[model samples]
Target: MSTVTVVNRLEIRFADLKKAGRGALVTYTMAGDPDHETALAIMKGLPAAGADVIELGMPFSDPMADGPAIQLAAQRSLAAGGSLSRTLDTLRAFRETDHSTPVVLMGYYNPIYARGVDRFAAEAAAAGADGLIIVDLPPEEAPELTEHLNAHGIHLIFLTAPTTDARRLPAVLAQAGGFLYYVSITGITGTASADEAAVKDAVAALRKSTDLPIAVGFGIKTPAQAAAFARIGDAAVVGSAVVQTLADSLDEVRAATEKTVPAVLGFVATLAEGVRAARR
Candidate 1:
């Protein structure tokens, strides 16, 4: 684990991950995925490959925003005996050697309710998690959850989709603590295209709501696609593509991640470097 550095805001952590001279390859995976014990192996493999941050997915029986690929991954992870307690333990184990990489838990709210918010927040914070991304409970419905996480000094990151209009941006930003996560594409996750012009527009709109660093995700796979996102948002997140990689073949997953983690993040890292270089 890297030394714990005092950070004023979660965006700083995101910025640090981007320091690899690439955009952030924010990979998502169910905690007890493929096999639960193998999760740490997967996590350990990611940082070296190119993953700046990890979206440590807490697998729920039902994932609303998720399409088939992620839903299946959740089932496998659950069947493998993955649970929030074990997931927290996995992260606790991770902190024994890896302290610097930012980890955010993304999932729905039902499991959280089942687990009890206070207990969840306490364990998550104690285990060294950086933040949370609850998909179903939008800002208006998030007071109880966000309040608890905030009280424990954990960030509750929110999703801002392309369809999020001006009226919605403020509400999203108000509930958002970490970096503002912008969903570059709409509908389910894992759809991709180079039409980032709309992404840039969303970024601009989000900028009006908050000065927080913006990390865009949804259907972002490959280095070229990552670069496009980094040009517009502060960071970019890659989910289902990598999840699919892991689901298809763990070896292929690692190989593919080795290619993408560095590939995508390297693109963002260069952008981060450029931003730093420009000041010189």
Candidate 2:
């Protein structure tokens, strides 16, 4: 086990939520979507709009787990010159003003691998990333990046799908830090609606093995859905729905950029309200 020296932002944020007796509202957006400046504006505004945590998607050409919304967002990001280097630069810039809100980089592993695991970990920590969620990196192959990330005080967040059985749960929980992201639905992102009863049962089962906070994502589109998940888990993660909002608001690259920030923030505030009101 790697010892974490620095105070992790995720731990702090979740602790604050526990103290407040409210679930967290975690939002996700692709880095440099539409355009770099617009995406940065959205990122900076998220915390103020009631986002407890932010997951910035590092654009990759082949995102297997992502659905059309996130895939399109990645395309737009790459088209606008979003790269691993650019993503870190955006994080560094965001850190200048908002140093408290936990930010996690979520995407596939190829980009990180191409950058070299050790170097990517070092750069990510230097750029103020609090954690990472590599969709394709299984626990068996995660040590390469986890060791480096853990050493730098950056958490390597893991995902547990509906298909993850009891026998496989331990392995996933072993490498998980910051939080465990539960894929609410069995398939790809943003396609199906999560079954509330199933999610409740899954969270209950997961709690028996690990004390880490569990955040449910995928198929969570509405505030009602987010509230339901929040009541069941420690936090609710909203991604594809928010990304779809960006897609709908875009006119062109620059015009869409102008509309994306406010539109996404407004939607996030509603989701936050739902999460905060859960169990109250």
Candidate 3:
């Protein structure tokens, strides 16, 4: 039997999302990907589209784990003057208007390291960030980072893969707060295929070790794919697709975001329904 352990702030919210049998649809967008105003607008629109949680991408110069698409998005965001401080401010702005949903800050470690770890945690927590996902930082070097984040009640969500053997998984799960972000496929951000079977197998493998809510991500692009994952995992995380939808600049980007937001939300709603249906 899997033992459910509650270790961080995000676990509380994530647990609630799961008890309801509804997987969350978390989308990642680079803060000021193209420009700040539009990024803010995209953040505002996400909740209405069925997003239970939002993962704001903190643009950095080098996103080692990220693939071409997201790397390019980061470049665009930086070129347009996105910064770590500004991203937190953007989150704070959204919180001023609506504070119901949870938010997580997803980014590379360089920017955080540049800003100083302790200060970054304090600012992120103050800005209503519930979790942190630093892709490049491995568990060994995360003690300092995790300690500071936990002190402020922020979940340090960690990523694990199929190759992360039994010995490593336990350690990963131990330090892993929030939900475990199970990378469905290996590589960069936006590759696609509704490979539910593969993702399902991965989730099953992960379930054998820990009861932490698992959110399957990395190329989930359709409602059908979301529904399929919602059946196996507690929730699903979507990226690339949303960012790609808003990739263009100016009028084209705005139009695409407007269209993409509702469509993705509808997909999440459908997946949530699938979760509800699963219990009965």
Candidate 4:
């Protein structure tokens, strides 16, 4: 496929959701959390469970931006032999059956850096990754990775926050594509709730800066919060909460139980309901 076609998948998804009169429900999960097979199962069921986009986490030892739930999830996945290659393989498998739902690889920069940016970009593109959210990479230092990603038709999704000032906002949006991720809270993921009024104003300001669909993440835990964010932003991303659900469903030995996949998908369904109900 052409690079344009590969890259436009994200734009196409958001456009479809906009026409449907609702925000996209972007669900996040660690690639091999609990175990490889179970994680793949949960990923495959996400679209039917009401996810418009899937943020497949690339597990790292030090996920400084995430909270306890996601940190533990990364640990579990790594312990089960989760690696960048394995994560890409899982995506390739998922693509065998589904092609439409956009998948963004979300993680820190260490793994990608070690894997070689150009090679990683090529592999990610071939594996059906539509975008990437490298939490630690700033726009200034992103040229090397951004160049390769752009060549492969992958979006370098950048994160903006409540702390992003007028001067800093321009740089963040400079090379951002697919969608802009808005970190609702200043701290870390899954800690504290987002203030609705603040988010509304923040998104409004972002809209004036760029037309890229803004996805609000961090601090979104429940269906109510998802619905609230859906009304304000182009997409609502729920990560740590979903990870926590999966963790809760795991067996005593930290292996996947019968309820693992279903529990996560069921929670996603409820959140999707809230998001879909927003504009209706």
Candidate 5:
């Protein structure tokens, strides 16, 4: 049996959101995207910009599930010396000022495997990360990492897709912690727009099987879309849109150092407003 762990920032944030009667605005940005310092600046500014939860992308050489925008972001991050160690350092730095906002490391599992699951989980918890969202690690093969993370009081968040049928949901939910990220689309991330009615129905159905918070991601771009999804789920995750925003505002040097933080934060503020006003 899975042991119930102590409340981390993720659970606290969701509890607070429930009290406020508003959904969360979860922001995703690649750590060290463009560069480490610049990405760290964006991370530090997220909370003040109204981000309830932050999903920091750990740069990987091959981000199979991502679209061109995110793939490019990873390439930029890698070029700028982004690695698993540096990603943890970035989180440690972000924890210096913001202790309440939850930070979830989102990526694949190879990095963790290379670092050793036990060592990775301990370091991640110590670095002040609240949870993890490993895209490629399904529930069946997750016990190796999940055991360590659970022991360290870190939530191992799981992703459910549009194709995840009824038979598989229970197994997925059984190992899921923090929240369930429902990929609102079938294909790669950011390739298409989310279908609202489909998302609403999915959330309603998932609620029947588990009480975990549901955060919809994939194809969510604008404040209007975030607001619509927020009304239906516990949170709305916007990734590709934010990555594209940074991409659009980059300087001639291909670095968003001068304008990325402010630009992305401003966009996040707008998203937060929409989420706060959802169902109101």
Candidate 6:
């Protein structure tokens, strides 16, 4: 078998951010939202708009952990013919113009399982994806997929929630790569707000266990909220609010309008400013 050596852009990005003395701004968007062309435009524009890392959400019919905004985004994407292959294509296209920005594929596991772990891993690696955030795939049950991704030098990023106590944390951190995503809230994504004090305590506790970068996500809506969480963690991830911006810009039929791409990118720029200035 031929071995492929990966550059590990995620790790390099984190190290660079650390040197700059600021937190990274991570943005999430559904691939093929409204339409493939508009979604690609937004993806291409993200890095210039100040996003440090891009989390390209893979559309799934049953995104249980996601709230209404993301669920609606997935619905719109699926209607526009979004699939695993198409999502990879989007990443590949984004890589054509911009290569340094780290991109993580975030979503559920069913689609990856349907495509087979090895094939999915190979395709993702070839497409310039830096990491993965499979929400439904717990570490205990992820060995098979993890193995395939490891062989390709792709990081299988894991999520830790507010309830991830001392006992459960070791298991979560053992196989985790790239970064540890800390779900600031307990329930589904974007429904409630993330308590700053609770998240500060949680991130402090997490630092005792692992040296991996912690990215705070879920319930972070505005620039101030992103700035607060970014100060607590190494990075800040914003999803539902970003998705909602895209959704709102769509036409009455849920189709992409002239405002779709610009609106999403503009909002991300504001959040990026918050994250960039957080530690300074």
Query: Who wins the TM-score comparison?
Result: 6
Ranked candidates, highest lDDT first:
4, 6, 5, 2, 3, 1
Stretches off by above 4 angstroms in model 3 are: 1-9, 192-194, 248-280
TM-scores for every predicted model: 0.84, 0.97, 0.87, 0.98, 0.97, 0.98
Q: Write the residue-wise lDDT of candidate 6 on 39-122 in tens digits.
A: 999999999999999999999999999999999999999999999899999999999998899999999999999998999998
For candidate 2, write residues 59-175 as lDDT tens digits. 999999989999999999998899999999889999999989999999999999999999999899989999999999999999988989978999999999999999999999898
Preferred candidate (lDDT higher): 5 or 6: 6
Candidate 1 lDDT over 1-280, as tens digits, reads: 3433434335666566456454555667678776666667777666655566778898899887887778877887888787788788888887788878888888888888999999998788888888899999899999999877876778889888877787777888887887888877777877555367877877887787787778888867665666677657777677776677665554433323334333333443443344333220
Report how far residue 6 has shifted in candidate 6, in Å: 1.2
Model 2 TM-score, 2 decimals? 0.97
lDDT per model vs. reference: 0.72, 0.91, 0.76, 0.94, 0.92, 0.93
Model 2 lowest lDDT segment of ten: 252-261
What are the runs in model 1 whose C-alpha is more than 4 Å off? 1-9, 15-22, 192-194, 250-280
C-alpha RMSD by candidate, in order: 5.3, 1.9, 4.8, 1.4, 2.1, 0.8
Model 1 reaches what TM-score against the true structure?
0.84
Best by lDDT: 4
Which candidate model has the greater TM-score, 5 or 6? 6
Off by over 4 Å in 4: 1-7
**What number of backbone clashes does candidate 1 have, counting pairs of residues 3 or more apart or in separate chains?**
14
The per-residue C-alpha lDDT of model 3 at residue 247 equals 59
Enumerate clash totals for all models, in the order shown: 14, 0, 1, 0, 0, 0
lDDT of 3 by residue, 1-280 (tens): 3433324445666777667756676777888867787778778877776677789999998888887778877887888888998899889988887677778899989889989999998888878888899999889889989988877778899998767878888788889877899888877788755477778888898988887888888877666676677667877777786666565433543333454445544544664454445441
Error of 1 at 267 (Å): 14
